[model samples]
Target chain A: MRFLHTADWHLGRLFHARSLIEDQAYILDQFVELVRTERPDAVLIAGDVYDRAVPPPEAVALLDDVLARIILDVGVPVVLIAGNHDSAQRLEFGARLMQSQGLHVAGCTSATPACVSLHDAHGEVRLYALPYAEPAVVRDALGAELPTHEAALCAQLDAIRASHPAGVRSVVVGHAFVVGGAVSESERPLSVGGSGAVAAQAFQGFDLVALGHLHRPQTLDGRVHYAGSLLKYSLSECGHDKSVSMIELGADGSVQITPMPLRPLRDLRIVEGALAELIAAAADDARRDDYVYARLTDTGALLDPMAKLRQAYPNALAVERTVLARGGVAGDAARRLREQSTGELFASFFREVADAELDDGQRGALEQVLAGMAAAQRESA
Target chain B: MRFLHTADWHLGRLFHARSLIEDQAYILDQFVELVRTERPDAVLIAGDVYDRAVPPPEAVALLDDVLARIILDVGVPVVLIAGNHDSAQRLEFGARLMQSQGLHVAGCTSATPACVSLHDAHGEVRLYALPYAEPAVVRDALGAELPTHEAALCAQLDAIRASHPAGVRSVVVGHAFVVGGAVSESERPLSVGGSGAVAAQAFQGFDLVALGHLHRPQTLDGRVHYAGSLLKYSLSECGHDKSVSMIELGADGSVQITPMPLRPLRDLRIVEGALAELIAAAADDARRDDYVYARLTDTGALLDPMAKLRQAYPNALAVERTVLARGGVAGDAARRLREQSTGELFASFFREVADAELDDGQRGALEQVLAGMAAAQRESA
Candidate 1:
């Protein structure tokens, strides 16, 4: 059984406050062509079908068009699972009815098997889909006391394994942050602290595990793979080689994995140089049409550097100045600013101003004053 | 042939910055029950399916559930058209596929016959749907220079008429502001001044013309009718008797119209009285759960009137004070203040302050100073 694994379409995403609907549409058209040519028996989208819980109308229309073309026009079955960015109920609205037409979408996580059985030269291969859920949701759904991502996922997977028929090849699809997987800036934090990560060993029973959530493609082992996001959503993701996973499951529970590249309409690139040299280079660069994030190394400020750069590269999103940070002093200061708490920063400022360390009583008084001010502000607001 | 005609659903509407999704869902569920009990030959939804071009996820989900229940579960045919609030292409997505499932949605006005033919015990009844379109859209679709709503609609109706076979009764559905139809504050203007009002005579030929866009239920003639909206959308529409239209089209082109009241989840009401009396009456009133707009006739300034009212009427949306206007002095002044332009007000103020009217040069200098201050503030901001 052959299937294509992809996720994080992020339809209706806004990049630098500009709508990326047209760009998404263009790339998805290419995705349709890819599906047609590949002729996968089923396509698995792990999660994040929409950028927000409530997508724009054009995004909804685009999804409707793509799904219809793939399911009705190409006659291919699709299995999808909702991610954190999707409203599960909204995505699952017509899932049961859509099943008859070979569009299987799982918008909620449960202990019960939400699997689609497909046949090829192999007798049968069951693909179990688990949509993204918070630890609390998973615990409630399973009627278990699992409190962490690993425990919740393990409980759900154990139930799935118990229900699995013996000697049938199986695949597991999930939207989770797996341990040892790399992440990009655009990927939202899955949990409040460091508790969202799950272990690869928990998913060991499945022949192949298609994962999502991390925006950079990664692999825990030969059997577990991250499909990653198709588009470069942030400048920090400029280095990511976005791709989808192609899985071929054999009759004897053996699997083969291949990476399929989804070329973006306009590549995202970061360029650094003196403003003049950067502009000169951009004029002759083949990738000038790409979305550019330029970092200028000029010590003195350049007047309207962005406008000047746009003359050669019209898609320059932003220009960064390295004037104060060339020797790393400003960079260190920024790092310290991010790492320190407000109370500690204030204490340091007080010491600098007074040229003496604050006594315990003074520090306590200062903290009380700050707390009172905060309380008053909250009350008035 | 019997059919239930409804329009101006305004799903995803916001009232006083609060989402109306829950209210809309409650009403639409009742609508589903109405469809089941009535068992009309077909249901005709005239237009304004959504409040905005892009609705939230819950609104989309609600519509999906309602349509599926009516078309798939209850096994009824529904014919709908796009309103000014909808994006035609978005609403039209998957329309052809939905047609096979007894759901007909027309998203754009066209010269082509956009009709769904349904058969009853007597004969075939053609429902010609013309979605809302601007003059430009209509002209482009028809390849004509028609410049007014009446002409554009006449052309569309002519196309439908030319496609109509003899000896068969037909109904026309449209989303336009007809002349002489009552309107409410919430209904958006369909076009620039004057041109939006289409003459009622233009729709004379159809056995029944279902109209939308006017929030007040009205009839230009016995044949042309506005179903109005399902709920009281604006405070100005407090007196509107909101209802859906039930039309029975005879085989010989005779039609009977009936108004069907849709029970709202919560009624909208306006209460005007002295503060003490209104509060006293609220204790005995059973409709305190209604959304209330209160006008208190207290002569002196009242303290926290809205907060006090909420003790009895928690859903009170607005409060107006009649303190200063009790004897009509403040009311007249407020009316004049609203009616006068800035220049006129400035002139009057100058006359009062200087004991004389200003000449053109002085007025020009004042205007320039105000303009300069505005420019400086904008620049600083």
Candidate 2:
């Protein structure tokens, strides 16, 4: 049995205040072509189908168009789940009706995760789809004491196992920050601390664990895989090679996974040089349309260097001054600033102004204030 | 052939800053009961399924539940369109997939309005659904000059008529402000000027014209009808007899219209008396939970009247002081204020302050200023 595994499409995402809908569309077109060529038995999209809970109209239309092509036109079944970035209710609209047409979506967390069965020459292979759910949601749904991500996942898996027959080949599709997985800047932290990470061994018995929520495609224990995002969503992901997983399962429940590389319409890249040299190099550069992040090393002031860069690389998204951070007193200060927490930064400012370090009482008060502000920010977020 | 006609549901609407979801749900339960009891051939919701372009999650869920009960449980086909308050693209999501299950939605304006064919022992009856569209949208869709509501409706009806076979009974479902229809404060104006109103003669050829937009259940020329809103949405709508229209079509295409009254969970009421008397009356009132707008006629100062009123009428939403307006100089001033437009009020204020009638130039300048402010406010709104 063969199936395509992909996740984190993040449709309607914006990069550097510019809409990436066209870029996403370009990549999705290629994905459709790949599905048509590969002819997988089914396609499994783990989660994060949208960038935010409320996607723009064009994004909704794009998803509609793409899904129609794959399901109705190509005659392939799809199984999708909602992520933290989606409104479960909205995504699940018309879900039950669409299921007959081969579009299966699991949006909300329930007592039992949505399971789809597929039959090949070897017999039935069950796919359990667990949508991204908060610990509180899981606790309420399952009537279990799930105070953390691992507990919630374990409770779900236990429920699935209780109902499962022995010796059945199964796959678990989910969205989480698994232990030992690589992280990127674009991924929203699942929680404030270590509780968000689920242990990799939680899926010890599953044939294949397909996951999302981290934007780098990598294998863990040769049984779990991340399909990564459709495109490089952040500058931190510049060096990452984005791809989807193609899973081939044998009659004996052995899995062989292959990474199918996707070519984005515009690649993300960073260029470092003096302003003059960078402008000169633009003359011979063939990929001027690629999204570029410029690091200016020139010490002297330049007249609108960003405007000049855009003359050649029109997609230049950001610029930063790195001359002071290269090698100087300012460089040491920058490094120290990067290393210090908010409380430490405040303590250093206090020492500079009062010529004294913060006492234990003052430190405790400051920490309380900082924690309150952080909680407030998180609530608003 | 008989069908139930309803419109202006305004799901997710807020009345006086309080969510009306529960009230809406209460009334919709009765509507579903009506469908079950009447068992019409089809259910037609003319338009205004939501109060705004983006409805709250609960509203979406409510619509989903109601539609599921009507279509999936009761086995009645529903034909719904989008009103001006809806985001056409968002509402149209999964529309095609839901069609086979007998949920027909016309969210976007096209060259040809959505047509659903129903049959009876006599013959076929075509229902043309024209969702709310701006003149610009109608112009683009039909490649015609639709400069006003009348032109747009005429163009759409023309398109429907050109292809409509002769001797076939037809019904038109649309969302627009027809001429001679009463206006209410709760209804958002379709346009800035008179162009928003369409002539009733535009539906002369159709057997029945089921319409929305004006939230009053009324009939015009015994042919065009409005199925009023589910509940009173504003203080000014307190006197509205909320109901749905039931149309009975004979074999010869003659129509019999009946207004099916709905009982709301709570009614909207206005109470006029001194604060003390109003409170005294509330003790005997059986419907204290009904939403109340209090008009206080007390001449003397009262402390925290709203708080005192809430003890008896917990759902009292607004309070107004009407003592001074009942008699004397203040009464005259209040009456004048009610009769004057903003420009007239400004002109009167200028006369009182400057002891002069404003010159033509000054009047023109003031008019421009008011126009600019109005336009700005509209844009922001």
Candidate 3:
């Protein structure tokens, strides 16, 4: 059996206040082309089809168009689940109705995880879809005391395991923060702390564990895999080699996994240099249309540096002054200010502005004023 | 062939700033029960499935639940279209996939109208669904110069007629304001003027024209019918008899229409009397829980009447002073003031306040001040 695994489309996402709909549409067109060429038995989307609980209309249309092309035009079955970013109820609107069309969606957690069985020469392979659910939701659905994501996921997997026939090849698709998985700035935190992280071992029994939420395509323990996001959603993800996974399962349950790289219409990149030098280099740059985040090392103030950069790199999204970053001049100044006492800092400021040190009499007067202010504050307290 | 025809659900609608979701859910439960009992061949929801283009998540869930129950549980097919209030693209999200499950949706106007041919004992009855579309959309889709609702409807009907097989009974579902159809305040005006009203003759060829947009349940020329909204959306619709249409189509193209009344959880009503009397009467009122719009006849001031009314009628939504209404003392006073010149009105007010008419000398001083003010106003203009 052969299928493609992908996730984190993040349709309707906005990067630095600019809509990525056009970029997403372009990449999705390529994805559709890939599906047409490959003719995979089924396309498995782990989760995070949308960027928010309530996405804009265009996002809905884009998903509709893409799904129509894949399911109706290409005649391939699609198995999708809802992520933390989707409104499960909204995503599951036509789940039952669409089942006949081979579009299976598990938007909300249920007592029994949604399972689709496909057949090949080896017989049947069951694909279990577990949509992202909070611990509370899992607890309510399963009537279990799941205090953490791991507990919730464990309960869900247990349900799937109990339903599966022994000795049959099976796959589980999920959205979670797996332990030791690389993180990206664009991924929303599943929980406030480490409690959201689940050990990859929880998915050990499955033939293949397809995952989402961590926006870096990678393999965990050589069994669980993440397909990553379709595009670079944040500057921190500029280095991510975005791709989908093509899995070939043999009759004896041997698995062969291949990474299928997705080429984005405009690549995201971080360019670092002095503003003038960056602009000069951009004039000769071939990828001028790439989404750029500029990190400037220039010490002095530059007038409308972003505007200047846009002249050569029109898609420059954001700018950060390296002087203000950690280990730079502004950081040093802030650290020094944190160590200084109020009196010493005031005296130093006076010296700088007045071009002279404070006299003893002036210092004494300042001390008296400070003492009075402290006394007044204590009284109020 | 028999089917239930309904429209203008306006799910997620808020009445007097309060969500009507609970009320809607209760009524829809009864609607589903009716469908279960009747076991209609198909259910036709003409349009306006949502109150807004982007509905709240709960509304989406409610629609999902309702459709699931109707299609999956009750085993009835449903044909729904998009009205002006819906975002066509968003509403059309799983349309193609859902079609096989007998959930036909026409969210956007296309060159070909969405038609579902249902088989009955007599033969095939073609139901053509024409979702609400602006004149521009119709023009673009049909490549015709449709400048008004009538022209657009004509073009759409023409397309349906061209494609529809002759000698077959048909029903055309639409969302539009038909000429001479009684309208209530709850209905949004389709256009600025009369251009939005289509002629009843435009739907003459069809066996029955199931329509929406008009919140009142009425028949135009005994052929075009509106199912009315599920609930009274505005105060002006308090008198509307809300219901869905149950149509019986015969092989001879004969039609029998029946209004299946829907009982709301909380009825909307206008109660009139003095503030104290209304409150007193509420003590013995059997339906105090109903949504009340109180019209107080008391001329004097009352303290927080709405708050007080809620003690007896917990669902009192609004209060109005009948004294301020037309033909009351305030209205008579306003009329008298409109007739009086500024000088005459001011003199009368001086007499009422000071217990003395303006003396000639006082009048002369007032006239001079008024003249100076008028001159300044003229200069500014």
Candidate 4:
């Protein structure tokens, strides 16, 4: 069955405090055109559909528009999941209602391993939405010791496989930082907190794995791949070969993946030169530019660098005149308070932060809390 | 000409700090069903689409589901605007993109009104999305100095007529406080800083003015009306008749607005009775038994009023005992400081609030500001 695979749209992102809503729309517009052209049997968005857990209203509008086009306009079933960046509660809010519109949204880690089987010419192709899972969530869901990311993912995948036996032609969609895949510079460092891991071989059983979270669209062992974000949201993703992965899974469990091209709103070019030269270079570079970020190598101070850059690039995301001077402070008091107790820490930090005073009662309460912590540590030891 | 009038949805609203998202959906479910049954030419969500400018993700998802149903599933043209409680920049974020899907969203209070003419069997019906306009916005738009709401609205209406020459079937969907519309208890006091006077005559020329801001579905002088909020977001709106207005414009300059009853999530009730009596009375009043609030008037604080009430009303918005009193020391102090200079008032208020001292430099700066204010008052005198 022909199906398009893409994920991590991350709409409503603000790169360097400049809103990327218009830029994001530019990319989404291209995506809609692709859906209209390709006419895939079903579209799979792995995860992290929004840049933030709580996206602005504009973000909502964008996602709504795109989903409508794909599901309603094109009359294709679209299966989606909530990624680490997404608020599961929000993405899954109207799942019961959206299901009637040929759109399947899986936000709950529990309704996971959710398989959507669509009838093609040959037979049924099951699509599983395994959202980014936490170890704790897995442990709670299965009552097993899924201590690491790999274990949690393995547990969930096992559950997903149980739903469909080995004969079922299935594709697993996920948002995880898997091992063996080169971490993209733009991808936020994969969290190893309460419920995350990046163990490779988690999706060993699936015919194809559609991934997100990592902005770089690439294949791991030529099977799993990160579709990446729709647009470049940060300078860290400076050289990201940003694109969506278009994967086609056959009824016989055969797979074909293609790199879909991206259309950027503006060239996010970084130039290094002297302050004046950098500004001039940016001015020369600002040919139908949508957004720009520049760094200067001037040793001396260039007064009002941003204002100067704005004279050339109206929407310069950043203009920092590099200070090549030696970094040496006479006495950095901050280094001393690092090991202080909650009360001493507060008093010392506040002494610098605001010269704000804390009365004895408040200080005493903090001291008691520290004492309690020490006692608990000792007891545990 | 035909159009469905709906307003005061108040997504992400809190009825005394309790979320009303579910109620919003419950009410909107019926709204969509009505739209399908009615099959109106277009739908107009006047304003207050969301309760807060930064709505919670739940509200966003709820709105997405509802809008998707209206614009995509039902395949009806939808016109929307940002209300007083919403941030225009946020609401209009992806409006330009949504226009492709036959959704016209106007979120700006600019010089010219956003008039989209619909070609129907009745020749043409011009739908103007004139959102909630404050005096400053109205004055800026019309190039006129204004105080009364009526004068400001008159100026804008005159401009619309001058441009569009309101046909017999021109409709204006607005979010504003008209003079005579009955304000529900839950509806926020519309005129806060200024006494707005949106006289009935200002709505002349337009066959139907779909109004919002006042969350009570009613006709003002048999012409203007408020399409009340979907579900009760505040206790004041309890027992208020909430519904969406359906308008049908004839070939002549006459119109008929039908108040389509929106099935509220649950009948909001505020009962004052003995704690024992209310709980004993809960078995019968449970019919779409969800989201409730109560005030108990027992002689003294009964043991765990919440627990007892929960037995009958599991989803109680709030259960407050009239016997439990709140301290009013701050209120009394605020009353006394009403006549003080701004600086003095702030300083004194902060001193009491923080219970802290101001250094010499801070105090002197504050005193100098207060003295400057005193001098200004003297000069004006």
lDDT (tens digit, per residue) of candidate 4 on A1-381: 777778878777777777888888888888888888888888889887887666766788778778877776778878899877777766775465556567788876883557788877778778788877556666887788876777778888888877776687878878898776656444544331122446657687788888887777778866787777777666766777777767777767777888888778775766667767756665456462656676677777578877777777777777654443222342233435443435566676767887778777866676556555543442222
- Worst lDDT run of 10 residues, candidate 3 chain B, spans B372-381
Estimate, for each residue in B271-336, the C-alpha lDDT of model 2 and write its tens digit: 999998999999999999999999998888989999999999999998888876667887988787
**Highest-DockQ candidate:** 3
Q: Second chain TM-score per prediction?
A: 0.86, 0.89, 0.86, 0.81
Q: What is the iRMS for every candidate structure?
A: 3.4, 1.4, 1.1, 6.4
3 against 4, candidate with superior DockQ: 3
* lDDT by residue (tens digit), candidate 1, B230-340: 788899889999888788888787878889888887788999987788888999998897889998887777889888898888788888876654457777888789656
Q: Judge candidate 4 at residue B105 and give its lDDT.
A: 78
Would you estimate the TM-scores of all the predictions? 0.80, 0.89, 0.83, 0.62
Best by lDDT: 3
Q: What is candidate 4's lDDT per residue for B149-202, written digit by digit as tens?
A: 677777778878888754536878887777766666555443432445477777
- Candidate 3 per-residue C-alpha lDDT over B1-381 given as tens digits, one digit per residue, 9 for 90 to 100: 998999999998988899999999999999999999999999999899998876877898899999989999999999999987887878899998888888999998899998899988889999999999878789999999998888999999988888788889999999999889887877766653233788899987899889989998989887788999999998888888899889999888888899999899999999999988888898898998999999998888889988998998999999978778656687888868875756788899999999998988998788667655543442222
Off by over 4 Å in 4: A1-4, A26-43, A57-80, A89-124, A133-152, A165-168, A189-195, A263-265, A268-381, B1-9, B15-46, B60-82, B87-174, B184-197, B202-210, B227-381
Sorted by DockQ (best first), the order is 3, 2, 1, 4
- Per-residue lDDT, model 1, residue B32, is 90
Q: lDDT of candidate 1 vs native?
A: 0.81
